[model samples]
Target chain A: MEQDPRDLEKAQAYWRENIRYVAILLAVWFLVSFGAGILFVDVLNGVRIGGFKLGFWFAQQGSMLVFVVLIFIYVWLMNRLDRKYQYDE
Target chain B: MDPWSVQTWTYILVAITFTLYIGIAVWSKARSTRDFYVAGGGVSPWANGMATAADWMSAASFISMAGIISFAGYDGAVYLMGWTGGYVLLALLLAPYLRKFGKFTVPDFIGDRYYSKQARLVAVACALLVSFTYVAGQMRGVGIVFSRFLEVDITSGVLIGMAIVLFYAVLGGMKGITYTQVAQYCVLICAFMIPAIFISIQMTGNPIPQWGFGSTLSDGSGMYLLDKLDGLSQELGFSAYTEGSKSRVDVLAITLALMVGTAGLPHVIIRFFTVKRVRDARKSAGLALLLIAVLYTTAPAVAVFARTNMIETVSNRPYDSMPEWFGKWEATGLIDFTDRNGDGVIQYVQDPERNELRIDRDIMVLANPEIARLPNWLVALVAAGGLAAALSTAAGLLLVISASVSHDLIKKTLRPGISEKGELRAARLSAVVAVAVAGYFGIHPPGFVAAVVALAFGLAAASFFPAIILGIFHKRMNREGAVAGMVAGVATMIFYILKFKFGVFDGGQAAAAGLTGDWWFGISPEGFGAVAMLVNFAVALVVMRFTAPPPAAVQDLVEDIRIPGGAREAGPAPH
Candidate 1:
């Protein structure tokens, strides 16, 4: 069966917005983890919080906490995108 | 507590959990192939989340991860970040779309998306190889736990585990496994948390393990827990607890490899197919992360507590007056101490040449309650928790292997004329045979159980992750590109691992001579998967540029999956 032309346009628009949200969220994830956690760890290590170095905290505990939050954010954002496109179930 | 009472408690707790699983299996008997394969797509999001947690946290995570952290210091964060961070990729990029595609297995998605039987066959092969490697480790874990608790040999313990798994898995399939996994998750988390809370309270006067990780010690010494640990490590010639020892590049590679590999695992991906809607898939991934984070966050605390307690308990002490727990573990060969230099005192240090203690990493979680002198019931509960983690993962992996063989290979490719009943029988029969094979490997393991399991993640990362991602997000990728990419990726990983780990083609030398100066860019075999996954993406993109684009119907299928609406209930597709 052929989809209506109007529905196709809506689907394309939904896809575009979904990709935008994913790209942005993933960039934040990479920056917090691989960037702050590893590459720039020396610079961040000069700073300390509690018993942990700033970079070391990101590597061990901070990145994972951020990952969990990022997923929930994506879920919330995509739900909004789905409602905007009339595709939510 | 006497040894007799400990044994009694272990038996009673383990028996109760097993009976509960058997009861659930009988109650959830599958009536149709769809019910057997994907649990009729009726699972709630939260229940699926709990089941995924139980299935994902294998014995390695429950039993050995803390031990690794205790020893490896900051380098252990690779596992902490790698395993949990992958859920973000799953929730955001993969799970919902795969659920919308409404398939029973990963091979189904790859086959349908590529519009080629050969692509399906390749996916099935990869899925089977990865699952088999993984199930072997779970089975070995079951053996280890049983041998410790029941005082039985490893081989007998493995056989008993195989029988229990076979009874439930063949009878109820995915439906039984799902409900049983929910129960197992409860048992494992409670078992894990009780001891951690006890140790935290004892050490830092804090009940929350996460907070206790940063709080000062309760011993009238104003020192923070991490600070004390760092000081102890430095005194012992070890790296600081908060500083990593591995090269930065290798750590990055290993972390990326584990993240992508976790996202690509067939057993994990199949859990999303059992959910009712695309939104449930997304929600379940989030819930699974929350459930998993409960343990992941607590583990580092356990690591710190165990390391500090162990050092204070044994350091500068006379060997003849060591704690009872030390002697018990030493009898089992897991903990070995020698009074070298006739000093009559034990010395546990970082320098291997002078170290007088050798402890297997697997003993950390199991011995935590004993080391802290917790009550007898909690110790018994640890045994049951270890079994739950191992059995749930083993059953999940066995199901994936059976489905790939019966549904993907035999029915889809060789005999499309087969009836639904015939396919169901094939799946059950294959599961029994797979269990037997896994049992054999568990008895006579190839190498260190945990290291072998790590290779499974590497295999998945190199072979499946890139192909699956491109299929979902890149509409122009063709069959030739995916097939070639998968082959190259898998072949490269296998060659590198075999040369470094097993010495397959290296003139029959037993040592890992290839891992020295000859290593590729200083990347270990465990971290090479990230590089190979990159190679897969590059090959697929470059090859697709020269090949014909996938037909329009395939493109439409990809487009349909990307949306969250119109997901059909998972049922038997028309043959």
Candidate 2:
């Protein structure tokens, strides 16, 4: 279980990058789902798209689509971070 | 088609699927305790994703969720937001690290991180309580599908479900459950989508239910489907499909509770442990969310379609000339028509004082094919799909419960000398007993099936989510803080539910009335868990500040768990 100091430093750096990515992604999640979908729904509802109020669509359909996309983005971002820090496995 | 043919089709489809599940169990039979516990950590990402989706979407999501949405209208968005939002938390905050921790169970992680058997025992109790509460709803879902589709009594239906779950779950363990769940994800998604696609095409000329939600109606008019639904809802005295009815604050609280609660659930969290690499855990979570979004997105569309179909088909129609589906459901007491004014026609309006047609929300998904005049075989397929959804979740919950009992309680704590084979046998025995208990509750369902399931999410959120997150992210979190936080969190949640939901400790009958205006800040029992979780965090932080920090070794363990390299194969821990 002995670790090289360099590997430890790399792991720490990797952890830092991972947390940064998580923070950015989660902020987007909250803004889209909670902010747009609920808190500011009325303002968005005034702007209609086809059959749905923009806010209503976000609450029911749009936020979920965004969530799926966000996860993929995290996956792609994390893979790169892993390789950068030599923790790709 | 006649009832006999429908019953025959249902029997054949269910039998084929059951046999397939058992065949998978035999094929993937566990060789060692590792295989039994975590599938030997060999599942591919996409396959694990599908299994996780199947495991997560229970009977409640498959059978009752759309029905609830159809009735609740915009308020139902709470479910849409809460259930799926938690996956974001799971992927970003918890799943990968826990997988890297390489434990057999959630309790195992808690125990090692806190370096206390007591902390593990508290988690075991919480996990069992949450899993037991959830399994009841799945069992009831099985019974509902059985009684309606197979014409069997509910008790018999539950027993049959018990036998099937017991066989596979006991024999194959996690390996069997994982493969069968992947199969179940296919059966259920197909079953769910075919009827939804049919109805969407009929109503909006859109084969994709997701698009059909926003598309214009098929009628010569260019009015959108949602616009038409709002008009219908207003005409019937119900809230508009896109408009909120509950207070915005309550909606926010409930959605947040569900989101955090979903993230904390042990059974769902356990799915991540079966994947091969830490990277796969992260990728599998994303993939699982994508698969789940397929059903989650389609559900609202199905709700809209089914609601519109019900109104047009039955509203203002004479009882004597009602559609075949209406009469069929009425025979089972799921649909009731009473013309109090002696009028021959049924008035399916929103007027509670004068409405003649009463429909149970649970029937919406189960009867959607019949309501839309879809083929008989497809109706039978929905039955099989509902069974798959219920059985997959039921088996998953049973496994978690059995593991808690046999591994966490007996071998880890009581009989440390037990051999690996003896532990595996104990796990299987515990699973059988767990199935029997779940089956009994399914037969005599504790009141509030959906509400009870919601409470399970709340408990998970309040108790485990905080503890596990702190265990990983807050290295200073000690055994005293973790254990105390769980007890306080769970106690507050249970007390709130019992007081508000069951009237426990209340002096008067009026006080016992559930979901009343008297609720604290209008927060329903289902939404109170979010508040309790906050309380848990506050208490834990304060307690930890006063107590000594965890040992340096525990801190090192936390740091090791955070890295993505070197996921150890999860096996029975060395005593």
Task: Specify the highest-lDDT model's number.
Answer: 2
Worst 10 residues of 1 chain B by lDDT: B508-517
Q: Give the runs in model 1 whose Cα sits over 4 Å from its true position.
A: B1-4, B448-451, B508-516, B573-575
Q: For model 2 chain B, where is the 10-residue window of minimal lDDT?
A: B506-515
Taking the tens digit of each residue's C-alpha lDDT, what string does model 2 give over B1-575? 56657789999999999999999999999877788888888899999999999999999899989999999888888999999999999999999999999988999999999999999999999999999998988999899899988889898899899889988899999999999999999999999999999999999998999898899988879899989989998998887889969888888889999999999999999999999898899999999999999999999999999999889888888888877777778988999989978889888888789899899999999999998988889999999999999999999999999999999999899998998999999998999899989998999997676567667988998999999999988989999898889889999998887777666676646544554687777887888889989989989998999999999888889889998888877765545
TM-score of 1: 0.97
Colliding residue pairs in candidate 2 = none
Q: What DockQ does candidate 1 score?
A: 0.77
Error of 2 at B368 (Å): 0.7
On a 0 to 100 scale, what is the lDDT of residue B280 in model 1? 91
Per prediction, the TM-score for chain B is: 0.97, 0.98
